[model samples]
Target: MDETAHALGASRTLWELVDRRAGLTPDRPVLLQGDRTLTFGELRDGAERVAAGLYGMGVRPGSVVAWQLPTRIGTVLLSFALARLGAVQSPVIPFYRDREVGFALRESRADFFAVPGTWRGHDHTAMAERLGARGVFEAYGALPDGDPAVLPPPPADGTAVRWIYWTSGTTSDPKGVLHTDRSLIAGGSCLAHALHLTADDVGSMAFPFAHIGGPDYAVMLLLYGFPAVLFEHFAMDTALPEYRRHGVTVAGGSTAFYSMFLTEQRKVPGQRLVPTLRLLAGGGAPKPPEIYHAVVREMGVQLTHGYGMTEVPMITMGAPDDTAENLATTEGRPPAGMEIRIVDAAGRPVPAGVDGEVRLRGEAVCQGYADPAQAAGVFDSDGFLVTGDVGHLRESGHLVLTGRMKDIIIRKGENISAKEIEDLLHQHPAVADAAVVGLPDQERGERVCAVIERRPGTGDLTLATMAAFLRGEGLSVHKLPEQLEVVDALPRNAALRKVLKYKLRELYG
Candidate 1:
């Protein structure tokens, strides 16, 4: 690790780093939204006051507080206040309903629950009460406030598990992922170092602030003393003005975000999407290489994709200075202090360029799942967390992900990579987005099914045309998708905008 990163990693806790950054640049803006701006100095003072109020309300260190609020200035203040008070916070995505929200509150045993009143046409306060949540209170425009003198000293330890983040839970109930202050800081440091960001750069947060990326992105802002715009509701038409208004230099949430920007740019051929957008970078779902080449060619911006998950916020990231082939074909390289190991089925190390399960051991990795029994099977004997992802490392140290172990389609007892076919489908001119899944088949055991969202104004896409396109692209005959389904939009999760493959299987199977 570099000296700057090493220093950031040494911080005892998240609030401590906030204090350090605020001390250095008290007047600099840390967050921007429309006409509102929150400076470093205001963040410190406001959070301290809110902490005092919460303390007065009997919220102390180690208190379990669950908050489900939108991405707004008040939400950030509440989160920082919890950090200042050393409370264990579990952030629930605002879009979650009674089923997921009830599970999280019950699992975490939260003592206090914060809701957003009536937001986006949903009555969260009533829902919290309906779920029998304890200490349910609305925290929106007006947060609790009190005298700062009543607050206790901030936490000194950074290694304690103070965060509980839930997974998307596509197959089953969500798993609570345990995280610490140091781990989140380490994850953000990897992103900041790889992106080569500076104080002059402006960023945008289009995803939900309750997601893990909220803290991960905040750490970068604190370390580099730059500002990022917050979008409570992000859409292509609505969000473009905010990006241009702030002169955002770096923008993107994930693959869906890249496609959205490209679509807008196509409406006006010669015009740049965001005048100041020089780089489009993010990672959550898989990135088709075609998207990389198209963004560079049409949008005239560099696109760098990385690999990360709920367990590890950042594993690998593509650097801005890397070669074009590496940026498009590989999920950048891991930073210093992060170890990437590829192992065979028996847990033996595999040779470079050989496909195997990807495992990780690093400061950015989560401690473990909240359920001890479930955690035991996630890590190997050597302490590396089995990522459940199938990939290989290239000779250049870059990571090449094939697909998920469960996502591989079996046809005639032959395993085929769904991601491989999906990547090839993305290169088709008429195909806007694609997802591949395995469907039950008596003859082939499991057949390949392709679900695609067509580009606007495009004619109906047929299975034969898609098959011919894949064949022309040099795809293997056995790997071709036998079934095709077209739709106006692909189902996606609200947080990372990742396509929900299970939903597709349920709808088409």
Candidate 2:
């Protein structure tokens, strides 16, 4: 989960960071790619020019411009240009397939679309051509046709619509989350503070900028006049050198990638890698206690656990200094200017000990979901966003997320949780990535089916093997997966995390 991208150095708006840096570190590199660098001044100038071009295209105040691209100078500049126009910029990550992408385009009603011509393997130009958008600006190409820009029309938080983002869905239908111009400014501030990023802190983004994590985080660092190492693609081979070359002081990515790096026991031959990095952020999936313990012991960097979604945005983040247990067990407590509650089925707040739906209320929350009726169902009577996850509160007073209320499977008359099975499966040495879903059973209402990706080069993790592993650990016969599907790699999203269970269901079930 990421808030808006604002500066932490002082009380400054997102624009103020660009303004200050364009003056202080005008020659300092603001963005970096393979042998390509854009100084702060150049970035500012390019953005203004691009904003002028966008204005020529009639992208005015409140217009929704959806951008889909891998990280690049163009992506960053165009984002700034859109912000300059007071247009709510929505970034579409690469992880989304056409189904998800088409859903967001319709729900956002985006007037202008920005994308690159080509990426490492994906074709951005083909996607742009397929969409047939009204105001299409290929960020990757040259658009010499320009005009002087005009100031945006009178500011209004007045329901003109903002960024319509899609969160990981429970059902097949993806959740369209909305955020306003004002909301982005307000929310991004939380990230700036929590990370303690400074102008000297060069951030290397591992995730795509379109998602809440990358650009939003980078935008905040940019606002602080820090150099941002923009990776066109998330290549670990490339990421390590950039970390050392750019002197990136802070770096982070999703839990899956963090696990990939840590679990592999990566070694660098030279001096200390990424010596300046102070913060390492991991989220997007449940972070097992063992993963966090390993990261702390090995990386020797502050681990920040963030909990977020496109719908609820960044709800809770476990700060580095908060405590080791908080980082391991629960998502951090509610941030400032936010309220959280554990509610039962009747929409009533339950006692702290009992597990129920997690509800949140804050400026950072989405304006609403896509459909009005659906929005009514998602938002509570008192205007709290209903997070479908179920969990209990320890006496220690931190959020302990257990499982999604919607993903819970019913077996015979008993409700069986996939999270319980998945967590137990993760403790095994062979299991790398695991997902549990209910399979139809004529006898028992539903039977548990576990789909797992084994550690690289591992053999087939059939039902018999899983059963033996579970039995050796304990005799929990009922909780075992009736079926197991072992694959090479688990499907992930733009964040290089988030198992696309919906896609898996469509592909397998």
Candidate 3:
């Protein structure tokens, strides 16, 4: 990290960081959305007023508030307002419906809830009310406003669990990953420093702000004093003009994002998709080596992919100065404070160049899951978080992720539990057995594929029917299977008779 960013990153709390940045560069824009701009000073001032309004609404320090909103300036203000009030804030993705939203509210025990009312043809407020959420309020256009004087002192402690993010971790339901302000700062700081961003660089947020990457990107902007264009709904056609308007120098979200831009670039053989775009960098799902080479060769820009998750947003990130071979093959190296240890199946540390489960010990690691039982056996005795990802560290220290030990499918950087989908599919009367797996895709990073064994004499099933059934079962739309294959029987082990998912992947992938 640079000396100035390192010093700014030392702030104890996110509120402190905001205050300090506002004091230094209050007039500089921190967030840009269409014709709207939120300066650093306005962010601090607006959040304070919103905090006072929330205080009047009975929110106190340690109060739990859950919000399900899109990528808008108002959502940012609301989130920072919760921070200013020292309230525990949980953000749910906008696409999440009753099942996921209800799970987040119940698990977080949210005292209050924030919704966008109705967005993208969906009624969020109605969904919240239907789920029996407490203290439901809409936060779409204009946020609550009040005098800043009514607010209490901003939080001083940064180690307290203030953020609850959801992720499917080898389970049937999403787990609440607990995080502290300091831990998030550490994660974002690593990302900012590794990317080597500067004040002159213009960034773009083309993904859901409710994801863990929201705070991670916000911290980067705060530290580097840069502004990023916020996209509520990202589509290639709609976002191209905005990128040009904002002069986006850095663009990317994951492998999917890179492929989208590359596809656009290919539309015109020699023309740049976005004239100002210079670097495309992100990480969530695995990046195929060809995607990296294609972006560099075809897009005429730098492409860097990394490794991250909801538990730890920035683990290792590819730097702009890294060798092309390293950038194409590995996920890059960890920052100073992060410790990556690859271990064998027996839990013994393995030497470099050998594949094993990747474990991490770092300040950026989350406090653990909200459910105590879910956290059991998550961290080893040495305090390293046992990441279910299997990878190896090269001699140059770049990490190469081979595969995952967990049964989660990452599609467009979102973790989808194969078990969750399979369990839901098993409930169908015509289905005898089901297995879900992720297949390689150039655009989505991975596409969900469900292979099923039909009950004898049962009619054949189509993907559309299976999807409608899952939707009726209250499963999130994003988790619905994209491809379906009917099989006579699922391949199984001879001894235990356990379904072998690898065989399904080989057959369908």
Q: Please give the CA lDDT of all the candidate structures.
A: 0.87, 0.67, 0.93
- Report the backbone clash tally of model 2: 4
Residue 85 displacement in candidate 2 (angstroms): 1.5
Tens digits of per-residue lDDT for model 3 on 266-364?
899898888888999999998989999999999899998999999999999999999999999999999999999999989999999999999999999
| Candidate 2 global Cα RMSD | 11.1
Q: Judging by lDDT, tell me the better candidate of 1 and 2.
A: 1
The TM-score obtained by model 2 is 0.74
What are the per-residue Cα lDDT tens digits for candidate 2 across 221-272?
5556667788877766768777888777777666655655553344742334
Candidate closest to the true structure, highest TM-score: 3
| Candidate of highest lDDT | 3
For model 1, how does the per-residue alpha-carbon lDDT over 165-275 read when each residue is reduced to its tens digit? 987322335678999998999999999999988888999999889988999899988888899999998877888989999999999877768877888999999898789
Over all chains combined, what TM-score does candidate 3 have?
0.99
Among residues 3 or more apart in sequence or in different chains, the pairs in candidate 1 whose N, CA or C atoms overlap within 3 Å are none
Worst 10 residues of 1 by lDDT: 406-415
Best-to-worst order by lDDT is 3, 1, 2
lDDT of 2 at 453: 86
* Model 2 spans > 4 angstroms off: 1-29, 143-160, 263-271, 393-397, 408-509
> Candidate 3's error at 7, in angstroms?
0.6
